[model samples]
Structure formats: C-alpha cells, structure tokens
Target chain A: MTLVDTLQTSFKAVLSYRLRSLLIILAMALGVAAVVMLTALGDGARNYVINQFSSIGTNLLVVLPGRAETSGSFLGAVLGQTPRDLTLKDAQLIGRLPQVRRYAPLNVGEAELSAANRLRAVTVLGSNANLIPIRHMKLAQGSFMAQGAGSNAQIVLGAKIAKEFFPRTQAVGQRIRLGDSRFLVSGVLMSQGETMGFNTDEIVIIPIDYAQTMFNTTSLFRILIEAKSHSEIEPAKQAVLAAMKQSHDGEEDITVITQDAILSTFDRILQALTMAVAGIAAISLIVAGILVMNVMLVAVSQRTAEIGLLKAIGATSADIRRLFFAEAVLLSMAGAILGFLLGQCGSLMLRLAFPQLPAWPPAWATITGIMVALTTGVLASILPASKAAKLDAVNALGKK
Target chain B: MIRLTAITRTFHMGEQAVYALNDINLQIASGEYVSIMGPSGSGKSTLLNILGLLDKPDSGCYELDEKRVTDLSETEQAQIRREKIGFVFQSFHLVPRLTAAENIELPLTLSGIPSEQRQIRVNEALQAFELKQRAQHRPAELSGGQRQRVAIARATIMQPSVILADEPTGNLDHQIGAEVMTLLENLHHRGTTLIVVTHDRELGARAHRQIGMRDGKILTDHTDDAG
Candidate 1:
C-alpha cells in the first residue's frame, strides 16, 4: 500500500477506539511532561545559584577566620572554629599584597537604633568605605564613608532602614543612637533585593572599630577581598592566607574561599541534580511504555476479527505488522508534541510564579523527551504487532 | 480454473485425530458455478478454506489456472489471493468502521491501487449493486440485503478469477437471501467463477454443479446437471 493509505488506515483505527488510544496518549504525554518540567526546574536552580554567586563580585574571595582542617569533626556547620580572632591588622596586611585590589574587614552584630522617637532592632554591618566596592553595592543619595582607619563615627543606612526610621525626614544627615553610641549617617543605600538569602536593604552600616567597641569584640566576622583581575584570584588567595598567618602569629587558622571554587562546587552539584531529576522522570516514561505495551496487546486481541478481515483481503503478515506499528508511531508522535507544548507552558508558568528562577527548558531536554517517547512507543508495539502478524487467518476469522 | 488432488487436512480433537478433509480430489473449470453442501460436521468449510488458501492441507497439490499454488510461499499465496480470488462470508465481514464504498474498495486498496482508479471502480460497483444512495452508509446502518450486496461488490471489485462464498445468505431472511443469491448468480453470469459453500440445499441447488460432502469426504457429485 501507499504510505498515505497505511497512514489513513492507522488513523482510522486509532479514531475508532478513541478512549483506548486516548488513554495511551495521555499516559505518554504526562511522562514526557514530567521529564521536561523536572529537568527545567533542576537546570533553573543550577543557573540561579551560579547567577547569585556571580552577582556578588568579580574575581572575589571570602576570608573567614577559622581553620577547617579539622573539618572531619564538623557536622552541620560550614563555619569552622576560629583558633584566633581575625584582626583589622590581618585585613590591612592582606590589602598590602600586589595581587589584592581591595579588602574590607567585617564585624556584624545586632543593636537597637533610635531616631525621631522610632526605635527598631537592626543588624549592624561594620566595614570601611571599601565595603561598597567589594560588596558591589550602590547608594541612592549621599556619599559613602571616607576610606580611613576603623575610627569614624559616620554610618550608612540601608534603604529599608532609611525609609522605616526617618520616613518624613532626611536620614543621611541624622544622628541615630546605636547601642548607646550616636553616629552621623553618611549614606542611604539603594534598594538591592534579596541575594543569597540575605536582604542588604534592611541593615545599618558603621565603622568597624565603633561596631567592635559597641559589641565589645575584637574578632572580625569575615573579610571580603577582590583580586586585581580574574587571573590573580588564586595568587590573591595564597597571599591573603600567608598574610593572615603572618599576622596571627604564624598560625594557619583562616579559610580563604575563591569565587571560582564555590561556583564550580555548586555547578557540579546542580549538574548531577539535573541528571538525577531527568532519570527519575524517565522512570515514569518507562512505566508509560509498559502501559503502551499492555494497551497494544489488548488492542490486538480485541481486533482479531479485523486482522482476519485484512488478511482475507490480502494483507500479508508484514503488512499487518506495519499497520500496527504505524498506529503506535502516530499516537506517540502526537503525544510527544503535545507533551512538549505542555511542558514548555508549565516551565513558563513556573518562571512566572517565581521570577528568580531561570526555568526555560534546554534543547537537550526537549530532544530527549521526544526521542525517548518515540523509542518507547516502537519498543512497546513490537510484541503486539508481531502477535497480530502471526495470527492464523482462518482461526482469527472464527473469533466472535 | 482450480484443481485439487489428494487434499487431506487433520485436526486434533483432544487425543483423537479427525480428518477434516480426507483425500479430497476436485477440479473446477474457468467461469463455472459450483456449490459445496454439507452438514455441520462435514468438511464444507475445510474444503472452502483450503480452496481459498486460508488453510494449509496436510497433503495436496492444488493448482489454479495451471499455476502450482499449493507450495507457494505465504506472501505469494496472499498475492494470488489479492489479485485472483475474492471471498464473501456469511456474517458479511464488512469493516464496520468504513463506509460501504470504502468497504467495497478494500481489496483494491490492499493491492495498492491508486485512489483515483479505486474511487472509479468503487463508484461503479456501488452503482452495479444498486446501492448508490447507501454507498456512504456503514454496514450497521444498512439492511441485511444491502450489506450482502456491498460484500459482493467488494468481492468483485478486484475482478478476481474465482469467488469463494461461505453460506453467503445464511443470516438473511428468505426474501433478503434470495436477493443476495440473485446478486451472486449475476456475477456468475458475467463469467467470474463462483463457488458457494452452504448447508441450505435450496441455495446449493441453484448452482449448476453440486457436490455433497459427508464425513470429511465428497459423497456425491452432480456435475451432469447443468443449470
């Protein structure tokens, strides 16, 4: 028969058993949609993590005061114990390195800020003027603190703190009492939204030493460092470690983490996650394949008389097999196309619902969905098509 | 023309071997009208199936138009079936999903005939069977007589050399059955060889040559009476 004739017959057969064929198509479509949507989510998460990290700084490195060499005993804490406090001298020493462009010593604590009779508890970030460049932050008004030793009483207000504390008045020139010390506000930061789970817009920034005096602590929480260029990141890390060791009495008690290292670690984890999600989704597809096989078997048995009639009208066994196979391929193709459309729409909806996630389905995911669906269909139909082909014309015709 | 010699077919009923066709030998000339009549246990269907190449005889040398077809491959047999033979079943095995015209065009479709030619032939067959208005009706929508007419139209659409009909009018009323019989006879008069298998003696008697079968053997042959 012509290709058109075979297609027509197969289409007619599928339409005749509408419910059965519809069930198979629905199963296949859902299987494919699951594969696509799950992969999109996984890939989106991976991309979002990398994007969050990249947004922090260029060629950046973080110095935390701790030696994680005894990491074996640390159960849930990523921040290891600090053998000795990281002093401002250590940060100053790191800043002297040729590979290091800038560094900001940090001291974080919580305190109540009272201004205009409105007092609210706020997280206090203690850093110098270099903190703006190192943390990639901007200001909506007023200048950032002048770069100097850690002795200034000038402070900056994050956008949320500015709007909440001094709503009717200019917050930049106001003096706010922070834990008994009064400080002049030098800047009001722009509204930078959430990043890496922290909202920088809701904090107050002050000089490192004043913060240390208020909190009565000497250890720096973290030191943010930027390498002169992308190629200098490793050298800057080694330099910073050496400087910290020198300042801390020749003891290696600090962990220096490069942005590349963190990025690669997250990249590897999310790659595996994407593959694992796809594999899990593929299990559903296999189940759908088995459903296809079961339905085809039932169809073959149900259409015994039709098979006999075709054979009686001069259809060879090969013809019968081709007809059945054609029907299966058609169903799978239609289902796969529908599933791809549905999956894309689902991915779009997910992105719309959570705008932070990059939920666009990748090309490989789309191709895999279609190819796997078609392959499953062909594999599932083989046994039933062969059975139909082997049926004896005389006996098949005798079936009521 | 068809010829069969020493055709034997056996079936295992539990542990007993029953000979469905025992050493049956027969010959039919071109354009001849013949009937095979028997009781239920007789070998009427067995002989008809073997003659139609729907069954394989345990031992036989069957020839059609001087071609040795008994040992032909399954595909070759199907090709012969497609090109040179037609079948009409008692239950009127018209594919219910297809319209009457499509059902009549089934053999031509299987043979890969172009749609234009197939459409012309189907239209002609529908007209010849006086089923023009019912051409688009499915088998379930047509009466017994109309369905049988469609089946005959399908059988003759390929213009096959021989038509094998098994109790073609068995399910119809007397009036409808007579109409169906007249349609088959009309094809016979057009020089297409017709072989009817029936339990109805009246249907069997209408054929020019009659063969009576019993106990898997031909008990009598009435070739001398030419209707």
Candidate 2:
C-alpha cells in the first residue's frame, strides 16, 4: 500500500480505541518529561556551583597548613595534622615568592561584638591591608587599615556586623571589644553576600599582628594569595608550594589550592550526583518501554481479525509489520512532543519558583530524550509487529 | 482457464494426518460458474482455498491459464491472488473500522493504485453494488445484505479474473443470500471465473456445474444442463 494510505488506515484503527491510545501516549510523555526536568535540574545546580566559585576571584589561592599523604594500601591521600605555628612570618615569606602579586595572612576566631546592650556572636578575621583587594572586599564608609594599623588596634567591621553592633550610630570611629582588647572601627565593609551558607558581611576584619597577640597564638588558619594575572595563578601556586616545601623541610605541611581546581572538583562531584539521579529517572523510561510493549501486544490481539482480512486482501507481511511499526513511531513522536513541551514548561516553573537558581539544559540532553523515546517505542513494538506479521490468515479470520 | 491434477491437501491434527482434499482432479474454463458441494469435513472449502491460491496442495500440479501455480512460492501465490483472484468469505470479512468506500478501495490500494484512480474504482464498485447511499457507513453499521454487497464490491473492485465465494451467503437470510448469489453470477456472466463452495443443495444446483464430495474424494461432477 502507499505510505499515506497505510498511515491513514493505521491511524483510523488506533483512533477507534481512543482511550487506550491516549493512555499509552500519556505514559510515554510522563517518562520523557521526568528525564528532561530532572536532567535540567542537574544542569542548573552544576551551573550554580560553577558560578559561585567564579564569584570569588578566579586568580585567588587558599593555603592551608596541613599535609595530605598518599600511601600504598589506601590508594589515596589521608589528611595529616596541621602545623599549629603558621605565623605572619610564613605569610610574608610566601608573599615574597615570585609570581605572588599579594598575600594576606588570615587568622579566624569566634567572638562576641558588644555595643551598649546589643551583643552578637560573629567571626573575627585578622589580615593585612592586602586582604581588602586580594579577597575583593569593598568599603561602605571610612577606610581599611593601613600597613601600621595592625599595631594600632584598628578594625574594619563588615556591613552586617556594623549594622548589628552600631545600629543607628556610625560604626566607623567607634570602639568594639574583641575579648578585652578594644579596637577602633576604621571602616565598614560593603555587603559581599553569602557563598555556600557562609555570610561574608557578618565578619569583622582586623590586622594580623593585633589578632595574633589578642588570640595568644601564632598559628595562621588560612592565607589568601592573589596572582598578577589569570595565567599566573598556576605558576603562583607552584611557587608558593615550592616555598612551603622548602620552609617545612619537604614535609608537605601546607596545601596550595587554586580556585580552578576547587571549582573543577566541585563540578566533578556534582556531575556524578546528577548522573546518579538521572540514572534513577531512566528507570521510569524503562517502565514506559514495557508499557508500550504491553499495549502493542494488546493492540495486536485486538486487531487480529483486521490483520487477517488485510492479509487475505493481499497485504504483504512487510506491509502489516510496517503499519504497526508506524503506529508505534507515531505514538512515540506524539509523546516526545508533549514531553518536550511539558519539560520546558516544568523547568520554567522551577526557574520562576527559585529565581536564584541557574538554568542550563544542554542540547544533547533534549536530543537524548527524543532518541530515547523513539527507541523505546520501536523496541517495544517489535514483538507485537512480528506476531501480527506471522499470524495465520485462516486461523485469525476464524477467531472472529 | 484453470486445471488441477492429483491435488492432495492434508492437515495434521497432532500425530494423525487428515486429508482435506484427496487426489482432486478438475478443470474449469474462463467465465464458468462452478459450485463445490460437500457435507462438513468433505473438502469443499479446501478445494476452493487451493483453487484461489490461498493454500498449498501437497502433491499436485495445478495450473491457471497454462502456468503451474501449485509449486510457486507463497509470495508468488499471494501476487497471483492479488492480481487474478478475489475472495468473498461467509462472514464478509469487511474491515469493520473502514467505511464501505474504504473497504472497496482496499485491494486497489494494496496494489499501489493511485488515490485518484482508486477513488474512481471505489465509486464504480459502490454504484455497481447499489451501495452508494451507504458508502460512508462502517461495516458494523450496515445490514447483512449491505455488508455482503460491500464485500462483493471489494472483492471485484480490482476486476480479478476469478472470484472465490466460500459460503458467501451462509450468514445471510434466504432473500439476501439469493441477491448475493445473483450478484456473483452477474459477475460470472461478464467473463470472470466464479467458484462457490456451499452446503445448500438449492444454491449449489443453481451453478452451471456442481462437484459433490464425500470422504475427501469427489463423488459426483455433473453439469446442471444435463441434470
């Protein structure tokens, strides 16, 4: 038969059982829609994480005073104990390394900042003047500490810290106590918001010297390093690692982490998680495939007499098989179209619900969804098509 | 013209072999109206099926128009069935989902006839069968006579050389059965071979020649004019 006539005949037969056809299409649509939406969510989350890492200066490096060991039995590194004496002198030595544009020795401690009767627990950060530009901090009022202000007991309060401690009053030029040592508020920092749940504007920044003396410890918690350019970040990291290796006598007591490496590791972890979720979602597609097979089997049984009559009227086995295959393909194509539209709408709704979330559905994902639907439909129709093609005309006719 | 020599057909019910047609020898010329009459299990339908190329004979040399069709492949037989033979079943075998027009156009469509020409043939068949008013109705919605008319229209739409009617009126009333037989005979008069398989003696006797069978063998082959 002509392809048009065959398709017309198949479509008429399918429509004769309208509710059953619709149910099969709906099942397929749900399967495809689930895959699309879940994969889109995974893409969005991965993009959001990458964007978060990029928000911090891409040329920045974080140095932690610890050793990571790789051994034979484990096949991976175990974290060694950190050296408790990472002082400002070490920070200066690292800063003097070639390719190190600037470095900030940071000491982190928890304390209460009190103004009149208002007191709140806040993270206190001790760093040099380089911390302002190196960490991309900005000022809301007054100014950051100068080079010698570390010995003068002056501090810069973050925007939220200042707002909480000195609500109606100007935080700059006021005194705030950090564990019995009162420091002048030299500047109020601009709001840098939060990353991964750590609020940047809720901390107080002081100079490195005074913080070491006040906290009664010489250990530096972290050191922030900025490179001269994007291309120099790796060179700077290697230089700092070499310096630390020399200083620690080849003990590998410090880690130099580049922002790119951190972002890539985060991306890899998120990608694995997304793939795991998508794999689970694929189970529904398998179920849909089975449903297609079952429905096609039922359809073959229901149309047995029609198949017999067609054969008796000179329809080739190939023709009968092609007609049934076309029916499956048409059903799947309809489902795919519906699923694509529904998935797009669902993703859009998610974007609207969570405006801060990023959306990045890759082109291959949509193509995969379409191909998967089509494959499922074709695979599901094979048994039924073969059965229909192989039916005995006399027996099938006698069945009715 | 058609010829059959020593045509033997067997069916296997488990380990036992049941012969449906046994050493059947017959010759029918073009435009001949022949009726196959037999009681149940007497091989009338089997003979008609073999004649129409719908079934294969086990040890036979069957020729149609001087071409041996008994040994042809299944596909070749199907091609011959499509090109030379049309079938009308007792149940009508009309596709219930298709309209009368669509049903009549089915054979032409399968033969790759273009839609425009198929439409013309379908219209002609509908007019010839006096089913034009019911052309759009599905088989389920049509009366038995109307459905049989549609079936006959479909079977003859391609103008095949022979028409095989297997109890064509078995499910119809007497008057409707007569009308259907008249339609088949009229097609026979127009130079097409007509073969009818039936158990009704009155209907069988109406044909130009009747072949009666018993115990898988032909008992009598008589010309109606002689009778």
Candidate 3:
C-alpha cells in the first residue's frame, strides 16, 4: 500500500479506540513535560547563581580563617582544641601587595542598636574606610567614616537600620548605642540588597578598631579584597594565600577564594544537579515508553482479525510493521508537541509567580524534550510492531 | 488449470495427528465452475485453502498452470495468490475501516498497481456490482447483500484467473445467496476458473461439476453437462 493509505488507515484505526489512544498520548506528554520542567529548573537555578555572582563584580575575592592544622585527629579539632585566629596583621600584609587595589578586614557580631525609644537586634560589621572601595558602597546621606575613624568610635548605618533607628530624624550625626559603647552615625548607606544569603542593607557598620574594642575581640573574622584590574584578581588571590601561609607558620589556616574558583565550583554543582534531574526525567520517559508498548501490544491483540484480513489481501509483514510503527511515531510526536506546549505554559506560570526568577526552558532543554519523546515512542513500539509483523496470517484469520 | 496429486494435509490435535485432507487428486480446468460439497470436518475448506495457497498440504504435487506450486516458498505462494487468484470468504471479510471503493481496490493496491489504474478498476467493479451508490459506505454501514457484493467486487477486481469462494453465500438469505452465486458463476462464464466450497447441496448442484467429499477424501466427482 502507498504510504498515505497506510497512514490514513493507521490513524483511523487508532482513532477508533479513542480513549486508549488518548491515555497513551497523555502518558507520553506527561513524561515530556517532566523532562522539560526539570531541565528548566536546573537551568534557571544556574542562571540565578551566575547572575548573583556577576552582580557583585567578578574582580573580587574573599579571605576567611580556616581551621588550624594540628598533629592530631579531626575529633580533637572538632572539640575546640584548635587555635582560631585570623589577625589584622595578615590583612594589612595582604593589602600591601602590589596587585591588590584595596582590602577591608571585617569582624561580624550580633548586637542591639538603640536610639531614642527604638531598639533592634542587628548584625554589626566592623571594617575600615577601605570597605567603601572594596564593596562599591554608595551613600544615601552624609559620607562614609574617614580613615582616622578606624581608631575613634564612629558608625555607618545601613539603609534599613537607619530607617528603623531614626525614622523621622536624620541618621547622620546621631549617637547610637551598640552593646555598651556609643558611636556617632556618620552616614546612611544606599540599599545594597542581599548577597550570598546575607542582607547587606540590614547591618550596621563600624570601624574595625571600635568593633574589636566593643566586642572584646582581637582577631579578624573575614577579609574582602579588590583587584587593581580584572586580570589581577587571580594574582592577588595567590599573593594573599602565599602571605597567609608564611604568616601562619606554613599551615593552610586561611582560605583565599577568587571569583573564577567560586564560579567553577558553582558550575560543577549545577552540572551535577542538572544531570540528576535529567536522569530522573529519563526514568519517567521510559515508563511512558513502556506504557506505549503495552498499549500497542493490546492493540495488536485486539486487531488480530484485521491484521489477518490485511495479510490475506496481500500485505507483507513489512507493511504491517510500518503501519504500526507509523501509528506509534504519530502518537509520540503528537504527545511531544502537546507536552512542549504544556511545559511552556508551566514555565510561564512559574515566571508569573516569581517574576524575579531567571528565564527557564533553555533552547537545548526544549529540543532534548522532543528527542526524548520521539525516542521513547519509537523504542516502546518496537516489540509490538515486531509481534504484529510476525503474526501468522492463517492463525490470525482463524481467530474470532 | 489447477492440478493436485497425492495431496495430504494433516493437523496435530494434542498428541494425535488428524488428516484434514488425505491424498486428494483433482484437476480443474480454466473457465470451469465447480463446487465441493461436504459436512463439517470433511476437508472441503482445507482443500479450498490449499488451492488458494493460503495453506500448504503436508504431502502434495500441486500444479497451477504447469507451475509446481506445492514446492514454492510461502512468499512465492503469496505472490502467486496476489497475482493469479482471488478469494471470497463465507463471512465476507471486508475491512471495516475502509470504504467499499477502497476495499475493492485493496488487491490492486497491494500489488502496487498505479493509483490511476486502481481507481479505474475499482470504479468498474463498483459499477458491475451495482454498488456505486454505496461505494463510500464502510463495511459496518453496508447491508449483508451489499457487503457480499463488495466482497465479490474486491475478489474479482484483480482480474485473477481463479476465484475461490468458501461458502460465499452462507451468511446471506436465499435471494442474496442466489445473487452472490450468480455473480460467482458470471465470473466463470467470463473465462475465469471458479471453485466454490459449500455444505448446501442446492448450491453445490448449481455448478456444472460437483465433488462430494467425506472423511478427508473425495468420495465422488460428478459432472452435470447434460443439465
């Protein structure tokens, strides 16, 4: 028979069993939809992380104190037997490197900020004047603390903190008590939003010297570094690591992180997540494919007499096989189309709910969804098609 | 012409072997109208199936137009069946999904005949069977008589040399059965060989020649040329 005739016959036959056909298509569609949505989510998460990192500038690095190495077991370190100290002297030495543009030593502690009758628990950040250049901080009123303020007790309130402590009054030049000490609010910072899970807009900033005295600590907890240029970031990070190693008696007691390393780690994590999600989606697709095979087998059994009549009239085994294969492919393609549309709708719904989310359903993901659907359909139809082709015409004709 | 010598067809029933057709010898000339009469399990249908190339005899030397068809492979037999023989089943096995015209064109289409020629042949068959008005109706939509006519039209559209009808009118009423038998006889009159398998003696006696079969073997072969 001509291809057109075979296709028409197959289509008509499938349509005759509308409910079964629809159920099979729906199964395939759901599989494709799952694959599309999962991959889209993975892509969206990766994009969100990359965008977050890019917003903070790629020419930046972070330095944090690492656990002190000892000639003992990990349990000993976990039991607080290890020394914990990252001194300002190391920060000063790193800042003096030629590749470093500027650096800020930070000490973080939670404290209650009280002004007039209002009081709020806030994260207190201790840093020097270099923090303004290292973080690219902007000002809403007044100015950042002067370099000399590192020795005197002066403070800069973040946007949200200023609004809470001095709602109807100017925050600058007002005195706010932090813990047991008082510092003049020299400026109100512009809203810097959240970064890496921490809201910079919700903190109060004071000089590193004042924070050390107020919290009664002598060690730096974190250090922020800026490169002279984008090309210098890696070199500056290496310089900081080398200096910290030398100062800490050859132990890797300080962790130096560059933007490239952070991004590569994040990329690796996202790649693994995407693969896992895709693997799960593939399992669902296989299930859908098996469903197709099962339905086709049932169809073959139900249409044995029809197959016998066609064979008796001179249809070859290959012809019968092609007819069933075409039927399967048509069902799968239809399901893929419907699934892609449904997935697109699902993504759009997610976007509507979370407008700030990154774009979902990357082009490759959509194409992969189609390929997965087609592959599942073809693979699932194979057994049934072969069985139909191999059916004995005489025996089939004899059946009721 | 068709020839059968020492043709034996057997079936396995559990642990026992039953002979459906046993050492049957027969010859049928082209343009001849013949019917075989038998009770149930008398091998009449088995003989017809062997002649139609739809079944193979366990032991046989059968010749169709001097070709040793018994030795031919299944595919080769199928080719011969498609090109040289037509079949009309007792149940009028018309494909339910196809219209009357499409069903009539089935053999032609299967043989890869060009579409334009297939269409011509189908139209001619429809006109000859007086089914042109109902050509578009599916098998389920067609009445018993119309469906039988469509089946006959499909059988003859290929212009094969021989037509095998296994109780062609078994499912029809007397009037429609007579009409269908007349259609088969008309094909025989047009210089094609026709073989009918029937249980009804009246239908069997209507043919120019009648063969009576019993117990898997032919008991009598009689001719009514004088009638």
For model 1, residues B58-169, the per-residue Cα lDDT tens digits are 9989999999999999999999888888999998888888899989988888899999999999999988999999988899999999998998898888899899999999
Task: Evaluate candidate 2 and give its CAPRI docking class based on DockQ.
Answer: medium
Chain B vs. true chain B: TM-score for each candidate?
0.98, 0.97, 0.98
Could you give candidate 2's per-residue lDDT for residues A1-400 as a string of tens digits?
7899788777886787788889888888887787788888898899898887877665889998765556434212253455444667789898898788988989988877776777778888888888888777788998777655546788888888888888888989998887777888899999989976768899998888777777888889889999888899889988888888788776556778899888889999988877776677667777887888899899899888888888777887888898898888888888888887888888888888888776545566777877888898999999899999988877787777
Candidate 2: give the clashing pairs.
none
RMSD of 3: 3.7
For residues A1-400, could you state the per-residue lDDT of candidate 1 as single tens digits?
Answer: 7789988989999998899888889988998998889999999999999999998888899998776664565332245455587888888888889998988989999999998788999999998888887888888887667645346588899999999988888888888898899998888999999899888899989988888899999889999999999999998888888877777788777889899999999999998999899989888888888888898899899889889988887888988999998998888888888888889999999999999899977789879988999999899999999999999999999886
The root-mean-square deviation over C-alpha atoms between each candidate and the true structure, in angstroms, is 3.0, 3.4, 3.7
Cα lDDT for residue A270, candidate 3: 89
> What lDDT score goes with residue B37 in model 2?
94
- Candidate 2 lDDT score at position A152: 76
lDDT string for model 3 (B70-132, tens) is 888666777787888888988888877789998898888777778899888898899999999
Q: Highest TM-score among the candidates is held by which one?
A: 1
By DockQ, is 2 or 3 better?
A: 2
Model 1 CA lDDT for position A303:
87
